[model samples]
Target: MTEPTFFETPQPVDLATIAEWAGAELVRGDGAAEITGVAPVEAARPGMLVFFDNMIYADRLAATEAAACLVTKKHQAKVPDHVAVLVCKDAYKSWAQVLSKLYPAAVVPADPGPNTISERALVDPAARLERDVRVEAGAVIGAGVEIGSGTVVRANAVIGPGCRIGRHCVVGPNVTVQHALIGDRVYLHPGVCIGQDGFGYAMGPQGHLKVPQIGRVVIQDDVEIGANTTVDRGANRDTVIGEGTKIDNQVQIGHNVEIGRHCVIVSQVGLSGSCKLEDFVAIGGQSGVRGHVTIGMGAQIAAVSVVNDDVPVGGRYGGTPAKPVKQWFREVTALRKLAERTPST
Candidate 1:
């Protein structure tokens, strides 16, 4: 995949001004030194701002050629004399602030331009598209589909019949939406497949009977589903993704799964059928939740965990057949000690 080019080039900002924006103190070197971009310590150039927070990258910090560095007071001593320093309580957070100031998000145009909504696009006459909607080339809008104002349906996207896409939503390239009610400002990244039939089947001696998926997918406002993610439709009840939920790339959300508000599901995570994730639940990358389990509000599941039981509210779980993090750590330590004591084969 080609990297997206930034339309707006960043103009150089002086170290002192950037420090003010990040709420950091300009502690050393010339405050007037210019910084044009933000990068990791090892990759930073003379006109860039870099950050050093962890001691694991101390070597990179010592050798960075950045014009300015965002550092904590504890690590300030490690910064080179020629590199200007902005001292802050949290170097990572301050560095993010600096980057945001330097490179603001580009605004996508709502109106159909020369590159959008080509004559080759197929839009059924029965489809209702509101004003300022941009349907790109090769996009197929089925009959009875309603797309609200300011929504952009990118190239080759397919919106099935009767689907309702709300205002200001972005249906990215190659996305397929069917039997879905999507809310305002939702972002469906490239290759997203919504409202597909779930993995529901009845076992029998003769053959496995496929259960009919009749329910829709209800995606609430401000939800952002990343590239290639799949949200399956419910078998009977509606599968709902609550407001402000962000699902990362390649994540799989099963049928009848109800995820509450502000949940963060990282990349490659899988939530099995009929699972319930309460508000503020965070599942790390590659985690798998068993079917019919309930993860309570504010629970945190570590990366690669296999959760087979209900998790209590505010719990931190890890490991296979996931348990509380503290117990998991103890078990791991005990196993390591036992291995060390055992005689070599």
Candidate 2:
């Protein structure tokens, strides 16, 4: 049996070319030194490039067997003489640039079939699709839907009535979109359910009266939503996902949520209705923001946190009913010390 290779192998590139692409200085290497692949310092081979940014991995750098490595000036001295060194201000960002040059096609979603629409797909006569739009098998596009050029609607995906998707988008397999307007270069991964009814109801002793959700979802450009994530429609206002925001899998976004540009929401995060996240906010995995709360710009919420109130700008918060990071750490340390000092019964 043979192992599977999903991407094509790249040709060998010399150290000088890699330095040029990464905007790095080849401080301790021959210009002719070449590598065919990239790997971690711990797992590097003779023809692989590795990156080191911290002194904590000094042992790995000291024993690296790779052809070359990318490092900062402060840590370059620890690298083994057998391995060549390329110096850069930001090692991780440089590595990303080098990878982009090596694997150009790896950044985008995979196309399942040709650029033309498959015969097994169903499209209403009122729906308009621009040139180079590909619709795969078992997909259904409803009336008055407009899809732009260079977009691919993959297998079994359904676009409900009056939905508009912009150019260069990829709607993945088994996705459902209703009452939504998606901007250019948006990627909705498999099983993403958009614009569903919100959990709004009038509670009573005998029965619960359901409130009608009458709003839509507006997703801006360069947004990538992961698999099985659900974005519920608002009751009277729109739920907006801002441009360049990246959301991980299994996230639950409640109605009327407003996420600002370039925010990152990790997996299993639950956002209650009307929560607002300002620009550049980062919410870690398994975090929850209470309804009507606002996370200020550039704030960071640590993993498994519960945010119940508004956070000030640039604050880093953690713990349940999340507080400032320094205070949280102090409280945690105090509890641990108290536990250690108390006599056991």
Candidate 3:
């Protein structure tokens, strides 16, 4: 099978033009140099634009073969003389601007195309598909499913019975959504599994007894779930993902988890059952939150942190059994000092 391509063909843009678009100043090299693509410093070839932000990548920046690079004033001198430098306040932000201009999001066609429902798709007669709804080849729409207008259910995807997906949502290829009430403009990437049974079982003499997950998954508006993420259904109460939340790949959200508005959950993060994340909570990659914990609004959990208790509002936490950032840092420093003081045999 042919892999789906989303990016458009590269368009050549001059150094000066890119600088103007990125709100950067052309500090060095030829302004007329044409850049055809964007790449990292290590892999940057001629006619490609790269960004240099960290000093740790100074060697890569110095060896880059790109036509131009985005850099801050402090790092401008580190750039090779042969490459044009686009100096900006924030090199990463400028690079992002350049990338956005070079590669804008593809517009989903309203008219039927490869993304549209194929003749091979199986849609139950009882299902209600709104106007312009696209179901790709091999997709299965179960009985009583209601899909809103402009929603695209991709190839090999499955929407189980009674699921209600709102308008302009993209249910990517191989995704399986059951017992879910999804709101508008949500994007579920490929391999997403929503509304599956939660990890709930009773330990008894006759082994574990499976507890029935009877609740639904409520996904609010503008939420985007990354590829291969799994959201389990609740035991009795609904599992809710609040509006505008962005969840990264491979995340696992347990039963009855309540994620508040605009929360950002990075890749490999796991939220145990019954946890409540208030508005604007940010969980970094590989973080795990224990069950029944309440993370207050605007709190940030550092990567690899183990959160086993409640987090106060606007706090920054890190380390195992997560605590305030400052306290964690002090503990780390003390441990390091103690280690250094110990003599080897």
Candidate 4:
């Protein structure tokens, strides 16, 4: 894979301006100086600045060689007289401002390739097609299916009639979608089956009949779904995803599942129908979630957990039959301690 190129160099900024921008007070140790770069405390040099978020590294303040440092208000006194300190309520916030000022990365647009599309392929005339937007021989596109400037739809990547794709969004080769809304900066890996048939079946007196999947999948911006991750269309309502939710390869998301923003679902994680996960939920690799379960915000499920019940907010859970993270830790610790204490005669 080709590494992306940097767009521009850092613009020089002073500590006073940084302090004003971050709503922090600048407590100077020396004259006002320009910060050209930022790095870890141990790695900072004469022209670069650094940040200290905790007290574990307070002892290293005497040895820091940077021009200045950003520290929390509580830790400001720990800085030695040799270095200047920028005190803020949150050191991380100040660090982010400084980093953004110093190291803004470049944005690269997708390059559309010269793949061929059939003349009869129904592409919306208003859709934006870039250099490498390839429509295959017989695919039909609805109006308002905005193919980002550089996306390629393989011979059969049937984009449902009215989808909006951001720049560089990839509708991989042979994928199918209908009435779906996709955000910008999204990537649909190859063989990804989105807006597909759900495993919905109706039981009659004689046999089981299939229920039609009539809903759509709404994917937010900056999401990267792995290859072959099949997100089933809803049964009656939309299956929605928040921004930056990453679904790993081969994951199965059942109908009407709502995944919150920035959640990471690892490979082979199976979410049954109508599950709701709040923001920042991290489902470990191969975990299975029962249908209609609501996982609270910021919960972490360890790998291979079989979650049959709802998880509380801001907790970590782990087990074959998932339990709270602290309990799981205790169980593992007790077993390990017992093994260590056993006689070795």
Reference-based lDDT, each prediction: 0.91, 0.94, 0.93, 0.80
Model 4 lDDT tens row, 1-345: 998855455677777776776667777754357877676777878867788887788777667888888888778787767677888888888788766655544222234356556685777786655555667666667666777655556556777666666665767666777657788778777778888778899998999999988888999999988888898889988888899998889999999999999999999999999999999999999999999999999999999899989999997999967999788889989999999999888
The reply for model 1, stretches above 4 Å from the true place, is: 1-8, 29-32, 105-116
Model 3: per-residue Cα lDDT over 1-345, one tens digit each: 998866865689888899998899998878887889888999999999999999999998889998898999999999999888889999988887877777766333234464356799999999999888889989999999999998999889999999999998999999999999999999999999999999999999989999999999999999999999999998899999999999999999999999999999999999999999999999999999999999999999999999999999999999998999999999999999999999977
* Per-model C-alpha RMSD: 2.9, 1.5, 3.4, 6.3
- Clashing pairs counted in every model: 0, 0, 1, 6
Best of the two (1, 3) by lDDT: 3
Clash pairs, model 3 backbone:
117-135
| Clash pairs (backbone) in predicted model 1 | none
* Candidate 1 global TM-score: 0.90
Candidate 4 minimal-lDDT segment of 10 residues = 104-113
Give lDDT for model 3.
Answer: 0.93
Q: Candidate 1 or 3, higher TM-score?
A: 1
Pairs clashing within candidate 2? none
Worst 10 residues of 2 by lDDT: 105-114
TM-score on alpha carbons, each prediction: 0.90, 0.96, 0.86, 0.65
